[model samples]
Target chain A: MWKSVIYKEWLKTRWFLIIYAAIGVLAVGRIFLKVQHDFTFNEATNFWYVILFQGYQYFGILKFLPALGGLIIAVSQFFPETVNKRIKLTFHLPIVENKVMIIMMLFGACCLLLTFGVVSLFFYGLSIIYFPHEIIHGALVTMTPWFLAGLAIYFLAALIILEPVWKFRFLYALVAVAFIPSVFFDDTITGGYSPANPVLFVLVIIMSTALLFSGYRFRKGEM
Target chain B: MVRLSRYFLVIIAIIAFSVVIPKFYWMAFEKPVRSPFVMYSCVENDFMIQKSTQDGLVRTDTRGNNYTREQYEEKLPLMYMRQLMISGTMPDTINGVFMDAREINDERSTFRLRTRDLFTPDPGLYPMFESQSGRANLEMPDDYFRITWRMEFVDANTNKILEEKSRMFSAVLYNRGFDFPAKSINGIPTTRKSIDEGYLVIDSEDQLFHVKMIKGKPFVEKVEIPEGLKFKHISCVDFRNKRYYAYLFSEENDLYILTQDDYVLKKLPVDGLIPEEQEIKIYADYFHYNIISDGEGYMRSQILDADFNPVDEYSETWPVKMERTEGKIYKFLFPGELSLSNSNSNYNAFFLNLNKSINWLVLSLILIVIQFFIIKRRNEKFKNQIVDFTAILFTGIFGFLAVNIFPNKFFK
Candidate 1:
């Protein structure tokens, strides 16, 4: 039953993921391309000076791409389920009410995690092409929260979409608007959020279970 | 399981509101309070205050004495050297000591250390320039060096390690008794300076060594640190006066300088200055060195003779932003805040600062009453809303906002 649910989610979000992966490659590729261009145009010594001393972020372009990937996955997977009460029919399956929704959300999360993982690997490969380990390491620390934001948005989107009430959806959206941008700090400080990275990962985990509450509310016919 | 799921959302919502509320409040009502530029004037033997206002820069003494622009420039000649020199009003001598622009320029250097500089991620690479390259200007080196098990220089153009240069430089360090795997490497690597003082690196054994590349050869100077001393930060300074190699800040909050006079480390007599939280300005001339540390809401200045002995000290205070009416309103509304960084730091840590004012309880009580009205109007039983009110009582407005946003239903 879970396999069937997973297939359903994959079928819904497959094309979005394909396009998202392409955009991810292009985004990460464009960043290194910029570094290459910068290296060619500027003195190598002065280039490192700007990056090291002036806090230049070569990989900063990848900051919002992961977040957009999360949002893309969430909207593609769940937005349609809310139309014409499609999720109600989904829960009418043999699986338990909460289990069906969980399986479906778990499928979206897995797809998101895989998509994000592949993007990160892409980032790692291209990062080493032009930068040393120190710079690559700094970009890795800075981008950790950005990747976590991808998963967080996925969970929060599932929680909001699976719920029955419109007002509650509005409330969740409001909280999310406040919550999501906190992860995308607006500075170029590298490893600035190292202490909060684990805590942010924990937030993503907690948000993963958020679907259960809304799933229960929908099952109880809260609307 | 559903209840616990709801619990998770509630907690996240609380943190969200805590950040959003204070952030929005400040965005709406925040006013910029200009802090007066405070410095010690050796001529008057008092602290001078320069404040910016609607008309122009208002200059005054700490004792409420105002002066014209010309008079103010004459008061602190060291600070207004360029302006005085431009107007041809420069005095030949200040305090009976012969002075010239060249000598004053050599003596003038400012050392600023902010918390952001110490707390951020180190790029772990430095450009080693020729200290005595005899060029008209300092030129950038083709490679950057990092210290791990040994000194490794990476070609800037290729991002590849230079094995020969690494071995050559590492041998200089090894011969000079530098332990492998350097701890903290500090240097001003920019080519903007007229001269390069190279790098002051601390080795694995906590030993200090000054490393420089002069005339295509490694020049290493091992510094003998005072016993039982722990250094917080050390940076090589390229002051034209040739007085000091670097400024060493100790863990004990003392500032020391490695003097060129036989590499002697002199502990400067400074008090009530935290480098991490304040802007330290050491304005030095032939007569006196004014060490001024301007903190969040106060300014403290210490006048030291050329020998670095403390002579006179002055401290002044004004209302910081948080002490104003807007801040008082913020405290009344938000019991605490979840901030990433503060005034002097950009480190993205989860910094939680709670409002300690007794008046913060006012908003909490008002919110509890509002929740009571909300529950009553919704025709919900009072007994079912205990947890909601309890949360509002303890977590203050943050919990109040969260509980209302996430509804709680119960079977009576």
Candidate 2:
């Protein structure tokens, strides 16, 4: 039963995941390519000086891509469930309805992890090539929030799309816009978000549960 | 499971609205504060004020006596020396001291300090320039240094450690009574300064040292801080006068200057100056050390004689945001404010600036009643929405928005 559910979700989401991974690779490649070009144009010392003293982030281009990836994955996976009440057919599968919903979301979560993990590995390799441990550590501390923001937005997009009523869905989307962008604050070259990142992480973890209510409401055919 | 999801949604919605609405209210209503520009007059021995008015800018002393432009400049000759020199109306001598623009420029300097200067985190590497390099302009060095377990320098060209130079510097540091690791370091790395004073570094155990590189040699001098004093921040100053190396902000909020007179830490007798949340301006002239602490709605100024004894101290207050009508309305409309960052730090986090006054609770009560009547009109049973009522009571306006957005149809 588990293998069947997993294979079913893969059939639904395989193409979108491929596109997601491609976009991740492209963003990482473009940013590091520009960084390499800039490193060659200026002396290595001068390049380090601007990043260290002037508060410039070389990986700033990767900031919004994670959030966008979350949104796209949610739309691809769940937007189909809302059409023609196709979720009713999904619930009819020979498993506990909520268990099936959890499986689907878990599948989407793994997809998100794989996509972002590839970008993170690329960042690690290129970061060590042109900079010292200090700049590399700064890049890690700075990207922590951006990656978390992407994860949070994914959970939020799931909750918004699973909701049965249009009014509530719009409201959830509105709230997401109002607060989620805050995680990606000013991209300082070094650490500024250390104290705040844990709170945001816990919030997103709690957010992953809110979509269950939307699933339950759809089962009851609430409008 | 359903009940838990509803509660979670309610809480999250309250937080989101709290973050957005109060900030939006202020975005529409906040007014810029107009503070008076003040400088101390050497001739009158009083603080001068240049404030905007309907007529024009009014120039007056703290004593309320007004002066014309020429008279105001004459009263503050050292401050307005260039203007006096440009007009050829400058004094050849004043108070038995010879006066000239060049003399004034060489003898005076300004240093402004903010909280972010010391508190903001940075990449832990610095380029040390040669102080006495015999070059007309300071040049950037090839390596960046980090003082961790021991001093280590990474060659910028290769991004690798120069093991030999690192060993040489660490040896000098160990011999100077320096502890193995440093706690805090502050120095300006740019070449724009008139001179290089290197860095003021506090060792792991609060021992202070002035570290500099001169002609390819290490010049590390341990500064003797007064007993039981610990520094929270050090603002390194490279004044052309060479009077002081830095202004030290102590953990107890005491301000001190590290004087060039054999590295003596001279304490300034002042209080209520928090280096983090206020803008501090220090203007030193031929005779007085004028320190101004500008805070949210008030500003305090003190003048000390050349030897650092208190000469005069004065404080003034102005109406701030909370004192205005728009801010009062904001209190009645929003229960709390949600902010990502503040003036003190740049990091983004959820900052709940709660309105702890009676006004906030009153507004919450009002919003509860409004939500209650709306639910009653919608034919939703009262007992079924106890959770919603509770959310409205605590979250006020945010709670009202959430309940309406999710409408308790199950209760109906």
Candidate 3:
């Protein structure tokens, strides 16, 4: 029964994964184009710095992409199918309601992970090509916190929309504001911006945990 | 709820560890030094100019030809050292004399000459001359020449002088071939212009003299009366020595003497007496010889003799008190008339303390609120998603930080 639910969730959002993949490929291609310029070793390093440091701001337009994708996938395929009346059918089919929801969530997480992985890979490749003289072996390693933060934001948004409580929407908006302040950490705050630092790492974890807890409360409270 | 609490504790622990550990490391190993001094040099030659020094060193490509450090230093004067101390450049060297000659006749012509001098020293440094020259002569129509006269000095690093000398040459011509009588005015042709105008007329045989143009008008005789009031000398307060001096000019036109403050026991004159026919003249043995008000609320004339002195003197109503309080220095109440507007903004200890406390409090509250939420949903799918997202984000942020914070550590 869990397998069936996961399969249904995957089938529903397959088109989104395809689109994300295409966009990721194109974005990565643009980064490669920049690498083709004739540059001194220092200039190349500076170019990579600009790409890495400013890439998030450029990608800010895509902030809504994951949340929107998650929302559509969750509302159309998961929530509607798991509505109070329809839930009985799913729960009674040799599987517990909790197991079905968990499987569906896993399926959605897999799709998100795939999308983020592709985007991160593209960034990694660009960094390598542009800063050939500089070592970028740790580029992906440093990106871990940002990737996690992005996923946390997406999950938090989905949870707020799905929650039974009316105030959850407001809470979600507050979290969004809080997220904005965190984004500015890279620019204004000295150590707050870096992902690799233990302090920022902890912050990412705490924010992620809060997002997850909020989602958990919504899921446990009602439909 | 218990599961949620566990999650919250875990997150708090992680954040605390991340923030605290690196800060400890930074404090122990990465504190930067206070001073990072470099040197620079400035030199000019026909082909190229380069300046380099031990502190604030700057090197530029001279297009293949390299200058040795020793050769560059030789051309520069010791007066430039003060300019270097203040991080200023030496001024350009453009010194020459101007000579004008008029023809009294083709072969025997009278002559008059006037010499003009122009030279600028390194801005902040005291200038010392090693050698200088100026001369004037004429070579027929359309040909004019001036030669540098011999002058040399080893400028005292401490004492600076603005010594300038000008000479006017005059002579009369007689046409011996035509039996023309020697041109004489009263006694001598050379004395004719001086006796008539009460001042010398500058000219040579080839150059003709005409009515002098004073501000575009024909020059007229203007009698000037010397005021009975005379100044002994004027000097600014030397903060380094905590003393003042008066520079006095003698009536006999002897050497000027710098007298100590004790020598001027009488109340010094506040206003300067100017010659009726001439503009107000303030004579001080300093670079900036401008009259200004001094302390005691009088519109007294003053001069900043040295580069280190304040660019301008305080106005009549400037405050004369300063004190230290709570480990910080403060200037006392200034007079309303004094211009203290250019002073730097005062430091506010209260604001600094308030900002620091607010930053810490906000950060702590954010941490606490996040922990509370994490603890409230440990077992939910949404909680897992949040954790997954956070893990990825934290990983990314950490990667970014590592790349930046430890560039040398990672690159190597």
DockQ of each: 0.69, 0.61, 0.01
TM-score (chain B) for candidate 1 is 0.92
**lDDT by residue for model 2 over B1-412, one digit each (tens)?**
5667667777777777887788778889898776777888777788998877778889999778999999889888898888988987778887788776666887788889876665577668998889899988888888999999999999988888999989888899999999978888789899887777788899998999988898988889999877889998888888777888899889898899998849988889878788877888888888888888988888888888888889998788888888788878877777777776776666555677877565777877887788778877988788888888888777788988877766666643
Q: Pick the candidate with the highest TM-score.
A: 2
State which candidate, 2 or 3, has the greater TM-score: 2
Residue by residue across A141-186, what tens digits does model 2's lDDT show? Answer: 8888888888788888988898888887888889888767644554
Which candidate number has the best DockQ?
A: 1
For candidate 3, lDDT tens digit of each residue in A1-223?
5666777667767776677667656765664554454233334323333433333232233334444444454454445543564544655667654555456556666677787777777777565434321124333333444555555554545445545556545644553544422331222111122323454345444443333333344444443
Which candidate do you rate higher for TM-score, 1 or 3? 1
Clashing pairs in 2: none
Model 1, A1-223: lDDT tens per residue?
A: 7788888888999999999989988888898778888888996767777777788887878888878888889889988888897888887898888778778778888887887888889889876666788877877888998999888888888788877888989999999999888654535487677777888888888888888888778777898
Clashes of 3: 65
Better of 1 and 2 by DockQ: 1
What's the lDDT for all of these models?
0.83, 0.82, 0.32
lDDT of 1 by residue, B264-350 (tens): 888999877677888777778766887788888888878898888888888878888779999888777878898766656666767
lDDT of 3 by residue, B225-262 (tens): 13342322222222222222222222221112222323
> Model 3, A161: alpha-carbon shift in Å?
2.1
TM-score for candidate 3, residues paired by index: 0.34
